[model samples]
Target chain A: MFRHVVLFTWTEETTDEQKATLAAELAKLPGAIPEIRAFTFGPDAGVNPGNQEFAIVADFDNVEDFLVYRDHPVHQAAIAEHIKPIAASRAAAQFVFQA
Target chain B: MFRHVVLFTWTEETTDEQKATLAAELAKLPGAIPEIRAFTFGPDAGVNPGNQEFAIVADFDNVEDFLVYRDHPVHQAAIAEHIKPIAASRAAAQFVFQA
Candidate 1:
């Protein structure tokens, strides 16, 4: 399986309502992309001692499926219409695994 | 690289000092495992609409290396001595990547 894991930190200045909207947009993608078997996102609990916050974990069946998910039209649309609008900063780790 | 990513959530009743100690314990494993190229951990922002918390993102050269890290004495010792004592709940997603 291939996994695309991203750590997203939205600015603290963001309102709770906005966070809700962002989550909604993320949810829309699973139905929009066939390669995405599982997509999960959540808030940062401020418990760890490091530079991180929200995380998004998306799983694919294989490398091709992952790359497809990465380049899917729905993904591009989501980035252009939703995610990029409010994200303060983001970092990602793409893990390519054979299982 | 093989990545073993885990999300750990400690009880809210847990104290800050104990959390600090847990982070220190996790940090030690990187030095102990030579195959490990990168390791990162942090708190859950609680901004996402999901069931996740603290996250551990560890990268290894290959699946064998990750399995080694998983079985290493230092890792086993940390879980036995530190993590198991304080964690309230935890979930993990292991990603095996070719690149």
Candidate 2:
């Protein structure tokens, strides 16, 4: 499977409500995008200090499937309308592994 | 389960051999640390430009199990001996979700 993991640092001004909304929006993606094999995401659990504020881990069968989810209108809308507005910094990586 | 996602940007001085060593070293963790439920990691697949250089996604049954993996001497040694030297910047987040 191909896994795409994204780490986000929220802006100081980002509110809890905004983060919650983003989470809710993200939770709906697996239902809307069939290419997504598995998806899990949430805010930091506070286990460590100085960690990124949020993370999303999505899995697909291959790069093509991942690309489908990447370009899907619903995912794009969520990023543009919700994610980009409050994100201070974003770091992402895509890698493949045996399932 | 509690999921830990970490993103790392490699220093320019890092070499392919070093990265391979890191990957090999990380592969041993699941066997050494019983708390690890699932682990997947690799260098960036070049699907997206300007992404972090590498990522590791690990899962545990709960925060306590995750903490065991986090503080395990073998895992810590891998970080100090391999990861810390080449990593220019690191961003991490731990979160929970249903299995």
Candidate 3:
């Protein structure tokens, strides 16, 4: 499986309502796009002081599938409409997992 | 369960051998610390041009258990010995997972 991990640091001005909306929109991606095999995302629990404000861990069969999700209209809409405006910084990584 | 996600960017000087050592040591955490219910770490597969170089997604029963693994001598040793030196920057997040 290929894992797509993204970490987000919200801008100071971002509100809880905005975050909730982003989460809700993100939750809809699996149903909206068939390529997304697994998806989990939420606000950071703040156990580590250095932690970002939000995270997403999504799985796909391969890079092609991941790109399908990435370029899907729903996913792009979420990024442009919800994520980019409120996010201060975004860091991401992808890796292949065995077992 | 609580998910602990950490992303790392290696300094330009970091070598593949050093990264392999870090991954090998990280793979041992589940056995060395029973509180670590799940642990996965590896170099980024580089499908995304903007992605960081590495990531770790781990799970624990709760914050207390997560801390046990965090403060474990073996984990600390790995960070101090293998991680800090080569890591240029680190970003992390934790969240509760329903499943």
Candidate 4:
């Protein structure tokens, strides 16, 4: 499998409503994009101080499948409409692994 | 479950041997600390540019279990001995979700 993980730090101006919207939008992706084998995302639980504010962890069958999800219109729309505006800093890693 | 995701960007001077050592050390944590329910980590696959170099994703039953793994001497030692030396930047997120 190929795993893609992203961490985002929200801008100070970002609102709770926007975050909620992002989550809602993301929750719909797996249904819309069948290439996604597994997906999990949420706001940080604050168990550790000074950590990123949100996370998205996804798994795909291979790099090609991951690319399909990456370029899917629904995913692109979510990123442009909900994620881009509030994102302050973002860090991501994509790697192949066996489940 | 509580999930912890951490990303690391290696320093310019970091070598392959150091990263391998880090991975080897990290692979031992699940055995040493029983609280970890799931763990996956690897160097980035270069699917995207300007992304972090490495990722670690872990799951625990709850916040307390997550904390136990976080503060475990073996984990701390791995961080101190392998991770800290080569890491140029780090970003992490810990969140809760139903598995």
List, for all models, the DockQ compared with the true complex: 0.05, 0.94, 0.83, 0.89
Q: Please rank every candidate by TM-score, starting with the best.
A: 4, 2, 3, 1
Off by over 4 Å in 4: none
Specify the CAPRI tier of model 1: incorrect
Measured with C-alpha atoms, the lDDT of residue A21 in candidate 2 is 95
Q: Can you write out model 4's per-residue Cα lDDT over B1-99, one digit (the tens) per residue?
A: 899999999999999999988989989999999999999999999989998999999999999999999999999999999999999999999998878
lDDT of 2 by residue, B1-99 (tens): 999999999999999999999999999999999999999999899989999999999999999999999999999999999999999999999999888
**A1-80: candidate 1 lDDT, tens digit per residue:** 56567766667777788778777888788898988976766665443345355667777887678778878887888777
Give the per-residue lDDT digits (tens) of candidate 3, residues B1-99: 888899999999999899888888888888899998877777899777988999998889898998898899999999999999998999999888776
- Candidate 3 wrong stretches, greater than 4 Å: none
lDDT of each: 0.69, 0.95, 0.90, 0.94
Q: Output the lDDT of residue B25, model 2.
A: 98
Q: Candidate 2: where is the Cα deviation over 4 Å?
A: none
lDDT winner between candidates 1 and 4: 4
Error of 2 at B59 (Å): 0.4
True contacts kept of each: 0.00, 0.96, 0.77, 0.85
The residue-by-residue lDDT of candidate 4 on A1-99, one tens digit each, is 999999999999999999999999999999999999999999999878899999999999999999999999999999999999999999999988779
lDDT of 2 by residue, A36-98 (tens): 999999889999999998989999999999999999999999999999999999989999999
Please report the candidate that would top lDDT against the real structure.
Answer: 2
Worst 10 residues of 4 chain B by lDDT: B19-28
Instruction: List the lowest-lDDT window of 10 residues for candidate 4 chain A.
Output: A89-98
Best by TM-score: 4
**Which of 1 and 2 is ahead in DockQ?**
2
Cα lDDT for residue A99, candidate 1: 39
